[model samples]
Target: MSKALSKAKGFKQSKSGTYLSMATTAYGVFGVAKQVKKARREHDTLRLLDAAVSAAAIVTGLALLVRELKRLGDDDVLLG
Candidate 1:
């Protein structure tokens, strides 16, 4: 049925979105870490501050992704 197909597609989309969000968050964290390491090596206070802010953003993104994933899990359980 079309309704069943739609539900399946929606489920896939939700899972894919969660995975993508987690992947992006991980990449952001890795990028910030690299920047911080480079800044430390160069002894640049400004760069360090920038890196710190970026790191904080990445952490926030990760937390948001975790919350979203949890929500998706609950939704999946409810749907099933």
Candidate 2:
């Protein structure tokens, strides 16, 4: 059980898994955009601000994921 859990944990850091995460995170941008439109339509300042914050967070997350992917690609080979 512990080994299986470890494998699952490791997969999250793998290239393919990182790509999948980035894809899912990218999808959140569309949802945030929809929220922004709705907020504008309803003239809700708070909701619009919330949506803006979410969009910023999503962008930051994608940037971090891209950096991790690049690092993983570069350090793929194990010297030891």
Instruction: State which candidate has the highest TM-score.
Output: 2
- Steric collisions counted per model: 0, 0
- Candidate 2: C-alpha RMSD after superposition: 3.3
lDDT of each: 0.76, 0.86
Q: TM-scores of all models?
A: 0.69, 0.80
Q: Among all windows of ten consecutive residues in candidate 2, which has the lowest summed lDDT?
A: 71-80
Per-residue lDDT tens digits for candidate 1, residues 1-80, read 67777776675347566777678678877777888899999999999999988888878887887777777765662265
Writing each residue's lDDT as its tens digit, candidate 2 over 1-80 gives: 67667667677777878889999999998999999999999999999999999999999999999999889974442211
